[model samples]
Target chain A: MMVSNDDAALVVERIGPQALVEDSGRFGVRHLGVTQGGALDWVSLGWANWLLGNAPGTAGVEIAIGGFALKAEASMTLAIAGGDLGATLDGAPLPPNGAFAIERGQTLAFAQPVAGLRAYLALPGGVVAAPFMGSVATVAREQLGGLDGRGSALAGGDRLLAAGTCAAPREMPMAPALPREDVALELVTGAQIGHFEGASLFATFNSPWQVDTRADRMGVRLTGPELRCQLGGMISEGIPLGAVQVPPDGQPIILLNDRQTIGGYPRLGALSPLACAALAQCAPGTTLTLSPITPHQARRRYLATLAQWR
Target chain B: MSDAQIRVSEAPVIRLETVGMDALMVRLFDAIDEAHMPWILAADRALREGFGEDLVDLVPSYTTLLVNYDVERLDQREASACIRDALIGLRPASTAAGREHRIPVWYDESVGPELPRIAERLGVSCEEIIRRHSERDYCAFALGFTPGYAFMGMIEEALATPRLKTPRQKVAAGSVGIAERQTAIYSMRSPGGWNLLGRTAVKLFDRERDDISLFRPGDRIRFEPITRDVFIEQGGDTTPLEERG
Candidate 1:
């Protein structure tokens, strides 16, 4: 459905770096070579939607590294969660992790990050955009999804709309912990994990790895130990989200939502979904340690986390 | 052989590997094989129906299928059971499974910068390289790297070329290229490392189409050589792509 200007809630004044519309993600289409594009920090996105009482996977604006400003087109209520990107209402600081009321012509601006790398802003209903392949999540590289239905990032002059009017506002007492200097990520060991040398395996979990600047929605390159794999190049196979692929150079890249469908490099294992959410919040140069967990343990933890939402 | 006899033959042993908490890597074969396509497609179809609402996404590649499931609905054990049951008594689909496509290509030095280099490396003329590449009907093994980008493969060994040492910063849409034994069309312009040989006007991926992607996993594909004029007439871009520093 087309969102007419009558219901337009906000208008983009400026965009710094990048911002995009995201939801749970695009699925059931991997065979078409389409990557699952969505909010990198999914936990926060859920909380943002929760604050507004929308479905957990409802669409929201993922503002990355701040410097985005929007002018309220109409009086409305919205929720902000995830990173503390120093959001403000007409120059007054608006705290993250709760719903707030804004008047017409009031400005909601996001400055440089004060905590995490990305913040999710959810509307009362949800950001209304034409869903491409069943999602409005933008994968810029693939040119799919977003306001224009071509994966374009939020830019000046773009109009934003919410599907429905607001209900009673809600708030969360706390938000997910912001990334720290030494964040420990939970990883589930599998797929070619035994092929790595004992020493490399030990280093993978025991040492500190720094997030490299080559980070994006696709994947994050962790620099630290030169992990050596005993196995040679194998046939290119399907890669799952969070698969830690170690290339010939030894730097391990943790593939994420927007990663390619297949890869040939050897992999140590994959990070748990929660771990991926945490890692997405870490700024480049943040130190990280890998904590091994079993698939059963990971599943239990995933269920427990989801249970908290309801 | 009869259908019953084919089913009686030893089925390839498949293994399942845990991918994080919610997904499993269903490994069909340890190596790449042309025969693996039918089995992969069959498994993909079965799992899509079997998992129903529980399945999040299933990614099929050359030798493995990564099944992403909803952990809220099924645990690891239950998901595995569903997978095994769906794959029970699995048989490869017949040779004639998916749609066949005839893609017309315009092969020229102006559009394919790597054409002369590839011919020189193979010690053959450009026309010979094009002839060898167009002669075989390739199987669409997978779709990836980008939307509508189908990785069709096993080009003539004589025509096979290694990927560029350094990927071109920009590869125009419809640029046909080969990397090792694999050949694919650049469905959308992006940075690519493949060796370009020609260009196609066909839109492999069109959002307006009922099926956004032109090629499915098991589709058969053949390349028909076309004149530059025909390529231009068919809406193919002939503007030379320069190698950016």
Candidate 2:
């Protein structure tokens, strides 16, 4: 079904620092050196879609650090999840986790992060954008995916068009708990895990690390104890999402979806997807601790969490 | 060696580890070498083919292939078992057919700012530098750092040099650089520390093309020295890439 001009959905009124169209993620193309661009907090993205009766992996907008405003071009059903970006619908406070309707001319504004760093806005059937590299997820550095197809963040004057009729409001089957202060980010050790000194490993698990402002979609830098590794010079190896690499500086930078396909720094391990999502919601200076978990335990917990969506 | 010996020899050293919920890191070698390239490429293709939809993404580096799969479908034990079985079906690298390319590069002081410096450091003339650099075929061991940027390697040792002390914030796409027995064309304009020797007229990455990336793992590349006028005529689009002659 085609979305006519009468129900054009959202119109960009004011823009924020960073906003991009994202989905489950871009896959099967990392071999081309193309980084997989996806929602940093995939849990919330899934919830936002669930609220609107859209597929869990449907494409949606990820509003980062707030300051985004959208005027409803047409009456439509939309949902917001992740972060308490201080959302207000036509001056009325709109909470996250449930679907809501906006009449024509109604403006929905996201002011600032009240709870989480990013909030996903899901419209019925998702906004219109052709999948690039098997995904509509956006990565600016690679200049791929998203609305403009140039891998750019949302700008003013952009129109969000969604297909499908407005239905009754829906909610997530089981919403993951919101992030709290000094949350522990669980990690499963990788190849270079044994190469690190036992002292550093002990400190890595015990120490409280501060999130450096240098964090981005590529990776998050933790400024705390210096993690020492015995491996002198390591060859650049394939890095996966949430790979916790400790550079020579001893600071561990957790690689994300937009991270370089490969790196040479010694790695401690990779964070579980849920732990990564919880860590992604954290703003700069947020205190975080790394907890080591067996790969089997991480996998079981992940499967358990994923069961909620299906 | 006989087939049994090859299988027995290859089986003991290959190590596999569960990277995350969605990936398995298969270690092929303890160090970097041209010999390991075949193993990396063979494993990459074999596992990718074997797993099919189960594999999300498989990245082949110098000595490892990080096989990313959907943990929802296959658990750690099952995925590792599939990988080990896939490794058993691998053939010798001599049978693999890698793509070939003759990339044209404008190697001169005017285009390559570090060319003269590189020549002086090696105590060789600029012409000799270009001749030695372009004469050999380089194998693309891996693709990383950025999209479509193939990490081609093992350049002739004579021209190899260390990377810049401070990497330039912006190195234009197509800028060919040689550092520590490796020469790679900057597939896109990004910050890099490789010693720039020349610039290529061809864009190795073109999204508009049916096959987005020009070079893949095991692809053979030979650099051809071209004049500035010829480089200009080639344009920035897909018209520049020439068939290897």
Candidate 3:
């Protein structure tokens, strides 16, 4: 799908908070030392795209904690997924995970989130944004991946245009709607899992940890009892998404999409791909538990999930 | 060579595992080292050439290759086999030797502020320290920590210094610095703590340029001293190395 200049929808004005555009992320350039900056909740972004009949990798808006408002200058079809942030269009309440036909000159707004930390807004074809290193994901820190390809965050007076015109609104059945409560994140034992003291390992699995306020696209610091490990003075090593690292402070910080490519800390384990998605939707102070699964099981489950998406 | 022979040869450095529904990571090695560079580069090229359209992107870090693909189009078994077959056909390229670039730097007080402290720790004159630093050629081990940031290797043993006890809030772009045995050039202004020796005017990273990065992994680099006048003429600011890129 492609969006032309004449067919583009303009953003006349924003009412509450601004929205930053994102895609899967700029990949393959990490060797050039670029960070993978992309949607915080990849699953939600994919769902938004699936609902709009766009490819899962298509670009969309990632609104953090809601309050984003926009006025459409042209008729368009859009989809919202991830956390329910009380989204409304032209003063009419809109639901998440479904497509809607937004008329030209109508205003779309979101209030403070009642649940979930981020909401994804997807256009029919996708958002038309400049690509940097082959991705339009906005990473404000590196100033890469955005409309200008300098990774600028959305602000007032910025107009968001859709890449392609909307077709008839597609309906996603509720049978597949993701469960919003009591998610169990799967963990795959990592290289340093053996380093943690035996009791600490048991405690890590047994105890409930709260997502601390210190959270962002980079990582989420989990608040829980101090977990001791035997390893020390680790040579800085490459970090993967969902790796549960324990720094000197002993609290676990699960790395995410916008995380640095490398780190030097003892890691307990990594969460399975689905678990990371589940964790992405979780808000601060949300309680979570760690459960280990074999790599075979993890791969099987992950492949099964992808099959459904296809 | 037969499949058995390839399997027995240099057991895959990275362990393959599922990252998410659509992502899989090939953990090159547990730690970073020069020995792993050839393997990593070979694996990256092999995947790209062999998988062709089946692969979304192959992300190579210090010791891991995150292979992303269109999950809707390919399954784990098929993808895993394709990756394995590509690895069997992999051969380290001669181009992997990489290119070399000589950067001109001004190591005087105008560009360098921590030079004196570094010289004192090494029990040498500041000028001597600069001479030793500029005399040797260095190998680019990896491009990481930041965009276009080349992490070179094996500085003079005497010149090796630990990162600052507390990192500076911001390090200037084009700042040439050393920490432990690794030396690096800061591509953009960001927080860092490497011992600053001097600065260069060349843009290490420019999104507008075809070659966005000035240096890459496995390149050779040397520092050539330049006058303050030449530095400014080249578009370098007069601030300390930490404040100018």
Candidate 4:
């Protein structure tokens, strides 16, 4: 692939509910109250980049729930990974988890979700957007990152550029299986976990929790047993990604990439990184369960997953 | 580092807790206090310098500093050991190290929609409320909610008010508001429930600026009352706030 200074690789013909450019995340500046904005299903993002022979943290477009369409301005090979959003290339069904070449004037459109909630589209190089605070991840709430560097979502008639040229598309041998059954999210319990009543702890692990409609990039609310914590009026502290905070109402909200930097609610624990990625693909009303795992086990699992990249 | 060099007369009791797979929380105290700033700042500095390329981010809040690290580069045991090594006998930074800022604000019923309501609730004049709010200096306890939004606090007990039951859909940039003892300026337009007292012309956050944010955690802030004309002269928005129909 080669680049021309004034040429756009693709043009946004139509955008559905939401589409944002995301990279690894913004970092080293949370003290300034900046949220780490990035792809929710980062594992998929890594695979998307890997298929295109780009670095794991390269920026890509995160298409949520479908209805997004793009026109190729130039002939190029692009990779699609993650959730099985009903995708079509030039009016034909386009399978995911592989790289495909599109000719100029061909239309690439996503109809609806066939399996998961989001799909990752990787440009030959990466989605080229002006970086804000060392990241191109769009955090709309904070008005940071995106095409204009103002956190604007991908809209109609937007021109997208590639950061650089790619070598050649590589064949993807194996992809992780999509979770179809009741998803089990592994939680690394700590931080106010002891304050929860014994029965609540049992229910937290034993019960089936449904994904509530009020879920987004900020956090996901789980409808389950009313978890009561004995602690009263805790001082607000820094919140990490995947922190499952139990508010006064007892419902747990798992904080995600764009969550507030600090919060006061009691926390049962945080979901492991892989668990968070798996949960990100879950649609509303998806049944899930929590399983407690030691920090050591969580780290070991994460390392094993990372080993797949090489 | 030698133990004698880092030892302090009264070191804060600390806890290093793992947060998920890639982060650790360094909890300094169970409660919030202005005195905790010195220690928090010290640990933040030590951790950043210690972790170097491995540190992802360090979020320093009221009572804890969250250290998000590169999981592939450093394991939990190695990260915990590094944190302990950097903080084992760490001395708290000087309280005087923080910068002091005097922010000018225009207090009135127009921009501050809740001013009249709060005055009536306390059975005091709007002028009296302004005076009470500006009489003392507040400490910047933490920065959250949005970029450059400093949560400052310990307002006069009499002036401490609860948040609104229903949050406003759009809180104008530079809107200064209070919820309980904490007061903050809305760095950008955001949905909020804080009882607004006034607005400021000072830019809380500016990406064009070298520092980006005007206030850092542990800084001191004092509000100074300004006339409407002064507020306008300083580039403050004077459009009266209105309820969404």
Candidate with maximal lDDT: 4
| Candidate scoring better on DockQ of 3 and 4 | 4
True A-B contacts kept by model 1: 0.87
For model 1 chain B, give the 10-residue run with minimal summed lDDT: B1-10
Interface RMSD of each: 1.2, 1.1, 3.8, 1.2
TM-score of 2: 0.94
Using DockQ as the measure, what is the rank order of every candidate, best first?
A: 1, 4, 2, 3
Residue pairs in clash, model 4: none
Off by over 4 Å in 1: A1-7, B1-10
The better candidate by DockQ, 1 or 3, is 1
Which portions of model 2 show Cα errors greater than 4 Å?
A1-6, A172-175, B1-12, B236-245
Error of 2 at A77 (Å): 0.6
What DockQ does every candidate get?
0.77, 0.66, 0.34, 0.72
Candidate 2 lDDT over A42-107, as tens digits, reads 889888887777777788999999999999978888999988889999989998666888999999
User: What are the lDDT scores of the predictions, listed in order?
Assistant: 0.87, 0.83, 0.76, 0.87
Clashes of 1: 0
- Indicate the TM-score of model 1: 0.96
Clashing residue pairs in candidate 2 are none
2 or 3, which is superior by lDDT? 2
Worst 10 residues of 1 chain A by lDDT: A1-10
Strongest candidate by DockQ: 1
Instruction: Compose the digit string of candidate 3's lDDT tens values, residues B124-157.
Output: 8998988989987776766667788887866878
Tens-digit lDDT track for model 1 on B13-51?
Answer: 889888778889898877666667778888888898899
